[model samples]
Structure formats: C-alpha cells, structure tokens
Target: MANLKELRGRINSVKSTRKITQAMKMVAAAKLRRAQSQAEAARPYAERMARMLASLGQAVAGNPDAPKLLVGTGSDQVHLLVVVTADRGLAGPFNTNVGRHARNHIRKLEAAGKTVKILTVGRKGATYLKREFASRMAGEITFQGKKRVGFEDANAIAERLTGMLEAGEFDVCTLIYNRFRSVIAQIPSDQQLIPAELPEAAAETASGEAQAWYEYEPDEATILAQLLPKNLAIQIYRAILESAAGEHGARMNAMDNATRNAGDMINKLTLTYNRTRQANITRELIEIISGAEAL
Candidate 1:
C-alpha cells in the first residue's frame, strides 16, 4: 500500500540491512571458531581441578583448620550472586537468559528471607540487574574493550571476590553464566563458588582411594589453602570462556536469522513494487486507448 518511491526506499533499506546482517553473521562465525576452541580446551583442566579439589576438600572436611574458602563462614543467611554476561549484545538472549536466571534466583532467595547481594561481571548483566537490584549491588566489573577474556581477567575478578569474602560481605557465593553446549545451544548454569560444594561421590572416592599411610607432604590442609584460591580462578576463567563462545554462537544464529528475514522482506517489497508499477502502466495504456477511440 505504498507509493513506488516509498516501496523502493523500503526495499533499499532492507537490502542494506540484509548486507549488514550477513556481514555480522560472517564475523560471528569467525569469532565463534576461536572462542569455541578456547572454551573446549579449558574444560578438561577445569574438570580435573574440580576433581582434585573435591578430593582435597574431603580430606579436610572435619578439620577446623581447613581453608575458609572451602569451609565457608558457617552461614548461608547472606548470599552473593555473581552474574556473568557478555559486555556486548546482538546475541539475542545469550545475555538476557543468564540475567533472567540470576534475577529469578535473587527473588527466590529474598522470598526465603535470605539476604541477597549482587556482584555483576560484564556490563550487560549489571545493566539488566540495575533496574531492580541497584540497592543490593556490592560491586561491578566490566571488560568493555578486552578483545578476549583471559585468565588474568578471571584472576582479577577472583581477587575482588576473595577480598569481599574476607570482608564478610556475603556468606555464600554463586556464579551464574551460560555454558557453551553447541552452536545453537547455550545452557545457563549456576555454580557454588564459596565453601565449594563437594560432591557426595568425592567423599566416597577419597575414602577408597586413600591408603592409611599415605600422607600429604605439606599436609592436606596446607595444599588446600593454596589450591582453593587457584581453583576459584580456574572456575571463573572457564565460565568466561564458555560465555564468550556462547555469545558468538548466539550472535551468529541471530544475525543469520536477521539476514534471512531481511531477504524475505526485500522480496516481498519487490513483488509489491512490480505489481504497483504494472497497475499504473496498465491504467495509462487504457487511458490512451480510450482517448484514441473517442477521437
């Protein structure tokens, strides 16, 4: 229902949009490759670390001298939710899904009469929570211009969190982020960071695997004190890598869909433009024939 000129303009606009979306999709694909590789590579190491910590944690389970990071401050009354999101979006719900999950968790904690504190990583997550959780924000970390998320980035976050934990800012901490599953599937997950949740299997394995005479050289407690902090950094690093890969995968899918939709719109507009032009030409020809007949 638009004039030819208007239709032409609309079609051109869609074509331009299509071009942009196509470019974005290609860029996202390129980025996804590297990000995905990095994420996949980190998994084995992280899992191994988790297993090691699980074993060490079991050894110190009943010991009062165990690292506080492993034993916690003995209260779950106050919870800190560390929400991780991408710094940039265009990745559809890659960021929003995680944010929504975190929000739901916060609400659930509040409903249970537990105090909630928020420590957001990435600008998008912070912005998402700020609308409702501004008062509960303990701090925020943004890696706006970082080309790639590295262990250093995770270490920085770990250091701040460690400081906060030492300060008694919160009793328990949970990290929420998207876990990279596939190009089309980024699953949001929650991990308990502080007082590291030990698997029941860990206790069983530890007892069976240990020999009565097997003794830790530096002592199990001493090794745990050192490893617990490194494990936190490793876990955080893995989360960031998974989030990075997932963001690219989500963006690639979103842009591909956008490009296809734009192409469809352009085709529809072109069809309308042709029909309208034909109608106008036919009317002009009819007028000429009628004038000649009148003559």
Candidate 2:
C-alpha cells in the first residue's frame, strides 16, 4: 500500500539496480570466454605431464633416495591444504562451495587426530576461513586488481609450497579448488600435490608393456629430478587456470540470474507504481466530485 511517490522511488531504484546487474552480466560473459579457453588449453598438457610422471616414477617410487616431492616425507602427521578461490565476490556460492569443502576436509582431518595447516590463495577464501581457522593459516596469497592470472602466478605458488616442504612444514599437501565443468557447473575438487599422486593405470601400463629396454639419455632418476619441479608448477598452473575459468563461469551465471531477478522486480514495481498512481488519481477525482456535489 505504498503511495505513488514511494512506488516511483522504489521503481527507480530497481531500474538502477537492473542496469548495474546487466552490465556486470555482460562483463562476466566476456571474461568467461577467455578464461574458459585458457583453462581448456592447459588441461591436455597438464594431464600428460602427470601421466608421464606416473609412468617414470613407477621404478623409483619405493626408493629411499627418490625426490621428496615424489615420495613425500614418510609420514601423514601434518596436512597442508592449499585452498583456492576467487579474490572477488558476487559469484553466488562459488567461493562458498570451496570454502565449505575445505572446512569439512579440515574437520575430518582433525577428527582423525591429524594436524592441519592451510595456505589460502584468494582474499575471499582467507576471509571466509579465518573466521573459524585463524591460527591454522600457514600463508595467504591474494592477486586482487590483476587483469588476468598467469603461469608466473602459479609458479610463484609452487615455489612457496616447495619452500614450505623443504622447511618440513607439512607432511602431505592437497590442493582444493573449483574445477571448470561448464557455464553453470563448477565442481569442487581436491588433488594431492606433495607425494605426487600417480595414476595406477599409467604405472601398470608402463610396467606391463613388453617393449625393448628403453634407456634414458639421462637416467630415469635424472629425468625425474628435473621434471618433478616443473610438473609441480604445471599442476598448480592448471588448477589456477581451472579456478579462473570456473570463477568467471560462476560470476557470469550469478550475474545473469541477478539481472533476470532485477528485471522481474522492476516489472513488479512498475505494476505497483501504476496501480498506486491510478488510485491516487481516482481518489483526487472522487474528492473533486464530492466537493462539487456539496457545492
């Protein structure tokens, strides 16, 4: 039962909101295309690198002299969770989904009497997790105001993780992020980084194949020593690309929904404004008729 003036104000406010949402939707859509392409392009190489590592490391997996990145620190006492999220918001539950997944993972680890540590990649995730897990934070990295996420960013993260591993900070390291699935679906995923989770299929294929003894120009151990670090960076880069693409997809989907909702609200408000204005005009006409009749 708002007055015409109030209804007009409400309608104007909704119209302004609608314009902003529409603009955001368009911007997100434009960004999603580039992000999606980059993410898709990075996947095959990343997968191949992982498979190669799995096949190559099959021989030395049980060796005590193997690289720690491939063999881990011989314990599962401390766990490092690399939680990745978008630096910005307005992306529906995109950030929330990963945050919740990480939180649940931490709780499960704690329940099993395991020590948990966190390395957050985005401001949103750091802010979200610090509410309940302030002390467990090992580090936080944010890339706000950046035009795009690049391989260098991922390499920097990998370097930090490597440094932490060398410092004996954590036994096992896992990366959690949103994987780009489609425009409307970004799946929360977790991948073990340290101790490089090798694919059994690749290992079995390599071991079961009856081929000539192919010797490495530089031995398998030498190749693994060189490839392991690069593989680490590549894996992290893939995660970042997937996360970037997923963030854009989520934001685009969210903004599209918001724009549609704003349009609906504007329509409803316009109808209400028209009804209120008509009621006011009829009331004024009735008042005039009443006065004329009295006269």
Candidate 3:
C-alpha cells in the first residue's frame, strides 16, 4: 500500500498526463479533418485516370510497341515493394500494420525463389522494417518534418522508379499503404505500381461493344506513350494522399483512447489518495483521544 504522500504525487502525475493526451487528441482531430478531405477529393480523379488507362490498355494488349510501363519487362523474377508509412509514431498500429504486410510479402516473394527489393517511404517504416528486412532495403525516402505532401513528391518518386526500371533493377513493383475508410478504420492495403492497373471491376468492362466504338486521335500507342507515365504519378500521388489521411485518422483515434485511459487512471489514483489520507488522519485523531482519556 502506498503512503498518502506517494498517492498524492501519483494522482498529480496522472492528471498532467491526461491534460497532455487531451491536447494531442484535439490536434489530431483537426489534422484528420483536412487530411480526410484531401484523400476523398483525390479518389475520384485517381479512379477516373485508372479507368481511362484500363480502356486504353485494352487496345495495345498484344502490340509490340506498347509502353513498357504498361507491359512491364515480361518477367517476374525480380520484384520491388514500395512500402508507404507514417514518418512519425503515436498512431496506434498504422505504421506497424503496413510493415507487417510488407514483411509477409517480402517473405512470400523470397520463398518463391524470386529476388525481392525494398523501397521504404517515411522514417517510421524504415526503422520498423529495417529490423528484419534490412538486407533487402534498396533505399528510403525520409521526410521527417515535411509540412505537406504534394503531387511533386509523388512525381519525383515515380521518376526515380522509372530510372531504376529502365536500368533493369527490378521487373515488377508494388505499393503498400493504408486506405482511409473512417476515423477509426484505416485499412492496410497494397496496389500494383509497376505495371499499373485499373480497378478490378474495370477488367470486366463491355469488351466487344466498348472496343468497336472507340477511336484514338494520333493513335492508341501515341496517347499511351504520354499517358502511362502520368498515370503512374497519379497512382503514387493517390497512395501518398491516402496514407497521409490514414495516419491522421489513426493518430486521432489513438490520442482519443489515450486521453480516456488517462482520465480513468486519474480517477482511480485520486480515489486512492483521498482514502489513504483519510485513513491516516483518522488514525492520528484516535491516538490523540486515547492519550487525553488516559491522562
């Protein structure tokens, strides 16, 4: 049993912690609103671009001159996993979940006798993944204090990937991230990046009817040459936006939970302190009364 003084000190500490957690929760809530809006806004544009790419892709499926970005290197022996995660912690499992998924993926790739390479974006993930997948790490993109994420960032990453692809560093690439579903739910997910894709639903489009009416201006090949790279950048930008939103959501939820738990602790400690102090005072009063009666 702790003495009255110790219990009082503990109560004070818990109250202070509760205040800090409350402040963090507020900040996270504000950030989450803005991030959520940005992510929601990007979804449609990204989906439309993906649909257009899919429609165009059908035209050049077998053509020898299709963009390499669309067709890949015709090999799956080497794979690159571009894992996206928060650059900071305190976001309950957001970074860890992605890292876990990537870890499993890397293991599966290696198991299949395929060479696997890792490219991590964000400081949090690099540290988390480096423990086990350190040998497979090809590079890391760290933006510790970057105020905002923008399309230019995605474009830069895409360009770096294109350079590596052109240099035959990897045959295929995949992106892993968290998709923001709600404040309490950020779904860890992955998307194919190297040989980009439309939504799975797009794959089942009206095949014969759609192809007969479509016409290209310069040519399907000519349009794809300009579009495929842009599409890649778009996809990456979408992933970044999604990840940014998810991180904030996770943080908000985490801080909220922390604040509540701290409040509960404060209540419990305060009760203990009051009871212990009362017990101490009551014992002192009894001792004084007994001495006076004896005298």
Candidate 4:
C-alpha cells in the first residue's frame, strides 16, 4: 500500500529502466547482423580445412613420428579445456552456459582420473569458473575494449596452445563455446583441437569411385607439418566467430525480453498509481463532507 509519492517514484524508475533496455536491444540487433554474417562465412572455410587435414593425416596418423599436433603427446593423463565466452555480461546465459558446460566436462574428466586445466578466453568465463576451478586455471585472455576480434587474435591463442603442447603441458585439448544458431537459440558445443578428431573416410568419392587419388607436391608429411598449425588457428577462429555471434544474439534476445517485461511492469504500476490517487481523492472528499455536516 504505497502512497502516491512512492508510486510515482517507482513508475519513474521503471520508465528509466525500460528506456535503457530498449536502447540495448536496438544496439544488440545492429551488432548481431555483422557478427552473424561473419560467423556464417567462416564456417565453410573451417569445415573444409578440417576435412582436408583429416584426409591428409590418415597415412601418418598411426606413425610414431607424426606431428604432435595431429597425434598428441601419446597420453590422456593431462587435459586442457579452452573455454570461450563473452567478456561482458547482460547477455542472459551466453557466458554461463559455456562456463557450466566446461565445469561439467572438467568434473567428468576428473572422475576418470584425468588432470584438467582451464584456459578461459573471456573475463566472464574466468570469473564464473574461478569460483570452483581456480586452482585448475592455467591462463585467461580477455578482449574487453576491443572493437573486433580477428584471425590474429585467434592465431595468438593458437600459438600459445602450441607452445604448451610442445612443453608437454597437456595431452588433450578441447574448446568449449556457444554455437550460434538463431536470434534466440544458441547451442553450447565442444570441439577437440589437439590430437585432431578425424572424420570418418567416405566410402565413395563424388566421381563414383571407391577411392579418390591425389598426390601431394612435397609429400604428405611435409604438407601436414605446415598445415596442422594453420588448421588449429582456423578452428579457433571459427569458434571465436561463432561465440561472438551467439553472444550478440543472446544479448539482443535478452534485452528484447527485458524491455517487454519492463513495459508490462510500467503499465501495471501506472494502473496501480492511478487507482491509489483516485482512492486518496475519494477519501479526502469524504473527510471534507463529514466536516461540513459536523459544522
């Protein structure tokens, strides 16, 4: 039973909040367009690169001297999880989803007697995971003020991962992030980076042949040595792009919902305020009439 002054104050506060949410929704929508396009464009290239590497690495996959990036350090004792999330919040569960997914993965790995290490790519993720997995955190990277994230950003991360692999820091590496699907849907996904996950070989070629024959110019080993690292960077870039788009989409959707909720609240409050004011006026009128009759 708030008085008129209190009701007015509450209404004004909600109105201000509604304005902010509306502005944020529009801003997120504008950003989502560019981010979504970039994410969609990177998918094909990344998929093709992965397929090519899978085909090329088939011969050397079982060899003892194969590139470590392709075959790993021959141990699954140590696992590295590279979790990608947004540097900022107010995007609903965009960052939380990835953090939770990574946490569950770490728990699963630990249950199986594996040592888990975390490499967070965003501030929100680091903060969320630091609560429980602080001891397991290997490193964190954030791009808070950066206007855009490009391949160079992904390359730097890839290089760091390569250095760690060479130093025998971790045997298996997996990336966790949100995959952009639509304006309102984002799927949390995990991809293996180190010791590349090879797709199954196709039984028939597009030309209707049982197998496709191709010859490498410098031989398979020579090509793989150079291609494996590039493939790693490309995969990371793709994941980053996907995460960027998903973040924007989630933010836009969240802001839109917030704005709508705010509007509904404002309407309810305004109705209540009017009713209260009317009630007060009626009470004052009745009091005045009672005084007149007494006089």
Candidate 5:
C-alpha cells in the first residue's frame, strides 16, 4: 500500500545496504583465507610441542624434584579461566560460543564450591563475561590496536598469568578458545595450562621406553623449569591463532548469508515496486479514458 515515492526510498535504502553487505562478505572471504592458512600452519608445531612436553613429563613423573609447573600447587581450591575470543564481532555465534563455553565451565566450578577467576583476552569475551562474572574478572587484554598478532602478545599474557601464579593468585588455570576445524566448523575447546597437564607422550617418556638413558646437560629440573613457561606462552599463542582463524571463517559465512538474504529482499521489493507502479499506471489510464468518455 506504500506510494511509489515511499517504495522508491525503501528500494534505494536496501540497495545501499546490499552494497555494504556485499563488500563485507568479500572482505571476510579474503581475510578467511590468510587466517585459515596461518591456523593450519601453526597446528602441527603446537601439536608436536604438546607431544614432546608430554613425553618429557612422563620421563620426570617419578622424580621428586620435578618442576613445580609439572607437579602443580597441590590444591584446586582456586581456579583461573583464560577465555579468548575475537576483538570484533560480526561473526554470528563465534564469540558467543566461546563465551558460552567459558560460562558453562564457570558454573560447574562454582557448583563444586571452587573459587573462580577470569582473565579475558579479547573485548568480546570481556564484554560477555562482564555481564555475569564481573566480580571474578582478574584482568582483560585486547589486541585492537595491533596491526598483527605476534608472539609478544602471547608472551605478555603468559607473563601476567605466570606472575599471578607466582604471587599465589590462583591454583588451577584453564584456557578456553575456539579451535578452527574447518571453514564451516569451529569447536570450542578448554585446555588446562597451569600445573601443566603433560600429554600422554610425556608420561611415556618418563617410563623410559628407550633402551638408552638420556642425560641432560643442565639437569632435567632446570630444563623443565624453562620449558614449562615457554610452553605456556606457545600454547596461548596457538589458541589465539586458532581463535582468529575461526572468527574470520564465521564472519565470512555470516556475511555471505547476509548478502544472500539482502539480495532476496531486494528482489522481493523490486517485485512489489513493479506491481505498485503498474497498478498506478493502470489506474491513471482508466481515469483518463473515463474523462474522455465524459467529455
């Protein structure tokens, strides 16, 4: 029932919106490619490092002088959750998924009467957590101003975590992030970092499966002491990479959907416009003929 002028304005507005959505979709697609590649490239190294750390952990399992990072602080009364998410959101449920997963974990911990603390790594996660866990939030970090994510960012986060641990801020620390599985699929994952959960391989290495005993130049304790902190930083870096890739993938898919929907809407609107215009023209012609007949 809209007049031609009103309908024309609506059509123009939609067209403008369509253009913006299309541009965003293209940008997301381009970014997704590079992000995906980086995520994929980092996976093997992170996995291998985890395996090696696990093997070493196994080797040192029986040693009384094992590194504190490996053995932990002997209590789970206090818990720290490091939740990572994208700094920006246009990405459907990407940030929401990560936030939800962290919230679930927090709820479970709280139910068990454990003290919960939060360290948010991105603005989205911080915003989400602030709604419910504001009191528990220990700190927030954002990469908004950075041109590119780097190891230094991860190191800074790790340093903060390590400093807190050394200061006896918390007992157990867990990291939550989205793991990029494929373009259409991302899995929310939770990993324990503090008290460093040695992978199965680490346990195997400790069992001495090899025929020859391995000797350490600086001693196992000393090596592990250094490796443990570095491993924590590496793990954080890997998680951030995974999250970044997943965010882009989600955004690309979301924008693609938006663009398609906008196109469909435009089509529907054009159809309506044509119908309205035709009706108006037919009405005008009939009025003219009636006037001629009256004359």
Candidate 6:
C-alpha cells in the first residue's frame, strides 16, 4: 500500500494528465469542425467530376486516339499505391488503420506476382510502412510545415506521379486514405486513379448506348487529355481533405477516452487515499484509548 504522500503525488500526476487530455479533446473538437466542413464541401465536387469523366470516357471508349490516362497501358504488372495518412500522431488508430489497409493491399499485389511501389503522403504513414515495406517505398511527401492543405500540394504530388507514369514507372496507380463519413465513422477507401477506373454509370453508358449528339470544342481527345490529369489532381486533393477530417475525428475520440479513463483513475485513487487515512486515524485513536484505560 502506498503511503499518503505517495498516493497524493500519484493523484496530482493523474489530475495533471487529465487536464492535458481535456485540453486536447477540446482542440480536436475545434479542428474537427473545420476539417469536417472542408471534407464535406469537397465530396460533391469530386463526385461530380468523376461522373463527368466517366461519361466522357464512355463516349471515347473505343477511340484509337483517346488519351492515355483514360485507356491505360495494356498491362497491370506494376502497381503504385499512394497512401495518405496524417503527418502527426496521437490520433488513435487513424494512421494505423490506413497503414494496415495499404499493407494488406501491398501484400495481395505481391502474392499475385505483381510489382508494388508505395508513395506515402505523410510522415506517420512513411514511418509505419518502413518497418515492413521499406524496400517497396518509392517516395514520401510530408506536409509537416504546412498550416493548411491546399491545391498546390495536390498539384505538386500529381505532377510527380504523372511524370513518373509518363516515364513508365508504373502501369496502374491506386490511392488509399481514410474517408470521413461522420464524427465517429471514418471509412478507409481505395481508389484507382491512374488508368482511371470508370464508375458504374459510365461503364453502363459505354456498353449500352451509341449517342450521336455529342460535341467537343478542341475535339474529344484534346479535352480528355486535359481532364484526365486534372481529375487525378482533384482526386488527390479530395483524399487529403478526407484524411484531414478523419484524423481530427479520431484524435478527438481518443482524447475523450483518455480524459474519461483519467477521471476514473483519479476517483479510484481518491477512494484508496481516503480509506487509508481513515484506517490510520482509527489506529491512532485506538492506541490513545488503550493508553488512557491502562492509566
């Protein structure tokens, strides 16, 4: 049993920890609001862009002159996995969950005799993956110094990826990140960007309809050439936004749990201290009574 001084010290330590956790929880909550709003705002635009791309892709499905981004290299031998995670930690399993998902994908690809390469977007993801997939990591990008994620960040990453693709570094590219669905629910998602995977709506149109009412300004091939690259950048930007929101939500929940656990521990320690002190006082009172009776 710890003495009063030691118990008191422990209680004080726990109280201090509780204060920190509480503060972190509040901070996470504030950040989550902004991040969530940004994520929500980006979703519709990304979806609409995807739909438009899909429709356009359907129109030019069999065109020999189609952009290479729409009709990819005729092989899936090399794969690039772009994993997006948080640059910082203390967000519970936000980073771990994404890393695990990416790792599984990498393993699956390897088992199929396909070459796998990784492009990590955050420090945490890079560190987590380095333990097992270090050799497979092609590159890493960290936004540690950036106060806010912007289009420039996505554009730079896109330029690097497209440059690598044009250089024949990989045949297919997939992006993995956590998608923010709600404050408590973040879903890890994988999307194929390179050799773009046409959505179901576009796929349907490609197989069933022959439309003669389509018009293009510079020509379908030229428009697709521009749109395909823009789509990649936009998708990356959306993924970053989603990851930002999910990270805050995960951190907020983790901090709340820590705060509650700290409170419980404090209560338990206080009870123990009170009981011990009461027992000590009873022992002293009994000794005094015995001495008086004997006298």
Index of the highest-TM-score prediction: 4
| Model 6: lDDT of residue 293 | 100
In model 3, the worst 10-residue window by lDDT is: 204-213
TM-score of each model, paired residue for residue: 0.95, 0.95, 0.94, 0.96, 0.93, 0.94
Worst 10 residues of 2 by lDDT: 204-213
Better of 5 and 6 by lDDT: 6
Candidate 6 lDDT over 105-158, as tens digits, reads 998999999999999999999999999998889999999998899888998999
As a whole number from 0 to 100, the lDDT of residue 198 in candidate 5 is: 70
lDDT of 6: 0.90
lDDT, each prediction: 0.89, 0.89, 0.85, 0.91, 0.87, 0.90
Ten contiguous residues minimizing lDDT sum, candidate 4: 203-212
Error of 1 at 185 (Å): 0.9
Backbone clash total, candidate 1: 0
Clashing pairs counted in every model: 0, 0, 0, 0, 8, 0
Best by lDDT: 4
Q: Looking at model 5, which ten-residue stretch has the lowest summed lDDT?
A: 202-211
Candidates' RMSD to native: 2.1, 2.0, 2.1, 1.5, 2.5, 2.5
| Candidates 1 and 5, the one with greater lDDT | 1
| CA RMSD (A), model 3 | 2.1
Q: Please, what are the lDDT tens digits per residue for candidate 1 over residues 158-249?
A: 88888989999889999999988899999999999998888665454566765233368788767777788888899899988889899999
- Per-residue CA lDDT of candidate 5, range 204-268, in tens? 54767653456776887777788888899999999999899888889988888888888888899
lDDT of 3 by residue, 1-295 (tens): 7997788788888888888878888888898888888878888888778777766787777777667798888899999999999998999999999999999988898999999999999988899889987898999997677888888999899999988999999999999988778788988888888776545533545443343446899987778888888888888888888888889889888888998998888888888888888898999999999989999
Runs of candidate 5 exceeding 4 Å displacement: 202-212
